[model samples]
Target: MEKCSGTTKATSKKRNASSTEASLPDCKKLKSKDGGKTSSNKVQNKEKTKMEKVSSKKKHKFLGSTEVSQSSKHASKKKIQDGWLEVTKNDKGQLLFKDFPQFQPNMSPKEVLQAGSFGGTYFRPIYSSVTKQHCEDEWKELPEDWLKGLNVPTQVASSTYRDRVNTYKVKCGGSLEMWESSGWIVTQDPYGWFQWYCRFYQGRRTKDDERQIGRWAKCAGVKGRWRNNLITKVVRSGCGFDNPTVSPVVRQTLQHWGYRLTKEDYKEGAKRVKPK
Candidate 1:
């Protein structure tokens, strides 16, 4: 569903999820036929603040009902403070943790940023609601290789939210206020889930890991509601797995969660849908 090219390129140092050390292909602007109305009403695009726009028009529920675990414990401050970041990947394109198999994210943080997510403002300066501290350059804590080739101002930490920076060219998630109000902003990664993910990918284990992984599962796991919902829509639309016009908003949401719907995943979801 995400077909447009991004502004920056980043390569993985570890063996790529593609079973080889392959660089991510440059995603150029994809040609489309449906005049951009690829999704049903569920994926309609409405011009709104980048953080406020929801993928679904009907009952746009975000971090609402699912209660977040109030986690005060976290990974050793010593290791994180010592500045250690190690990134690895499973050959299957899914980062699988043996202890947390339910948390299988295909994209690395580098891939996610390179794919153009979060309106290019995810790591921007912010006064955290959880930490109550003005945090700047916290993104620098991430692996430099992952942040390579990224424009810090416009691509990594833009003060302003630019929808054009997103590969989908559509806003698809809830506001930061919603995240904080929902009690999902843990102090360890006050910016949000993706921040936690970047650290987690680099061996920063935390007590908050389970809760964060559960959230990722709810959004992108095998039976993840958002993931499954988008798959069903794809099956209903009868589009190819990479159809850019189909549910761009939902695709963008999944992208932020570090999962992209693959052809194999689409076919598998179709079988389950057909049986129902």
Candidate 2:
């Protein structure tokens, strides 16, 4: 089973907008020729120009780097942005294909993390500096905000997979060993679907995207057996959507699969069931 995952000191010396005009000889000359009135006007003009420049720089910082469109040229380059690194080419220098159409997942990697999928034990054996560094690099590539309320793996004991961290507060999936023996583990995404989803969301399109996407589609898509059957069973019971007792196991299962059972889904299923 796939377990889900500053200051600038320069202003001190500078007083006010007048300081800008004070440095300009033209303004001094204008003041000498036109008296205090023209000096005021020039100062206003200089201040406006200064404000504009500052505003432009702020916008540039806010926008950051432009995302290069995925193309043949960019295939060999590695683009690092936010907290993650993107390598389009392998060590062999051959382009890994990522031509799948954009698939907008219902939940983002951050949302899943905050929601507490994977029982906090997903990232295990992180005690060593080498392993810790590997985990740090992965988490760093994501938005810094997504990790605010999370449990950072500190020790092998506490960080060991705890079902309490999951949204359902229960273990819902098989162990990594089971997944590997079942042949569900892909070498590219050793953690399974959730890992693939996270990497895919990060824009690291590899030769494995299509296969991974296909696997997700089969498991969680609308016609998915796991989801549709559970919805049918829950709705027929006439239990309210908010009812925690309604298929908690299946709900946890879906969450592990990177999908959540919304009230709308429950209501729709209720509509289909004949009242018992």
Candidate 3:
């Protein structure tokens, strides 16, 4: 497995039975018309050549040099605006962005960190499969103010997930490998969507912006499907809009995506779900 950039960082556990089998075995030999030894040797040589190639490809696929991705040629050009990380929220807890009206995340990246998200393991030291590098201190890239009072051990880089560190104080297992394979984990943000959000918030727009925004739209936007799903659960359970006990997992998930479920959002999200 690729190093999990998020909650699913790769482990150094002992390999299973499969790791012991590195030798190329000659199972069966192709027979010539006369069943000659020379032809048999040639066939064995060909088989060994093919097996060696396969083994080499596997090695190359997993052990790619980190310098290529860590020191990436596709790095987003620096463009710090007047108020690069400035955030102005509407009175009702809605993010207002003039450039992209379609994208709306209720919480800024700062708020997400302050309120506790990612089980404090989002930025844990990780050997990233996407970057082929052991990335531990990447979280330092964020604005210092964002991490002011937060403890790096339990709230920023804890190796293990601590449910108590989350805003909801609920256990949420968001696998990095799964999202990475689904094409959401781009080379720009190996830690997945939230990392991308942080960079975007810091006023760095790259080729991955549109795609990242699209993901937010589907997960936490005005008519986002995940938002609608949470609303439906809240309504169906007969719980109040602010009830923490109702769908805590989804709430935590939204926070991880840089959103907070506000009363206004709950009210609007309610309209998307019917009585049943």
Each candidate: RMSD: 24.9, 16.1, 23.7
Candidate 3 lDDT tens digits, 152-202: 888988888989999889987558777767666766678888887886776
Tell how far residue 170 is off in model 3, in angstroms: 1.1
Cα error, candidate 2, residue 96 (Å): 23
lDDT of 3 at 203: 58
lDDT of 2 at 89: 42
What is the number of backbone collisions in each predicted candidate, taken in the order shown?
A: 0, 4, 0
Against the true structure, candidate 3 reaches a TM-score of 0.69
Compute each candidate's TM-score over C-alphas: 0.68, 0.57, 0.69
lDDT of each: 0.72, 0.57, 0.72
- Model 1 clash pairs are none
After superposition, the stretches of candidate 3 with alpha carbons farther than 4 Å from their true spots are 1-85
List candidate 2 stretches off by more than 4 Å.
1-104, 126-140, 154-159, 267-276
Tens-digit lDDT track for model 2 on 87-183?
2544422224344433323556666777877777555533222122223233444456767866567311135667777777777788766777777
Which 10-residue window in model 2 sums to the lowest lDDT?
1-10
Clashes of 1: 0
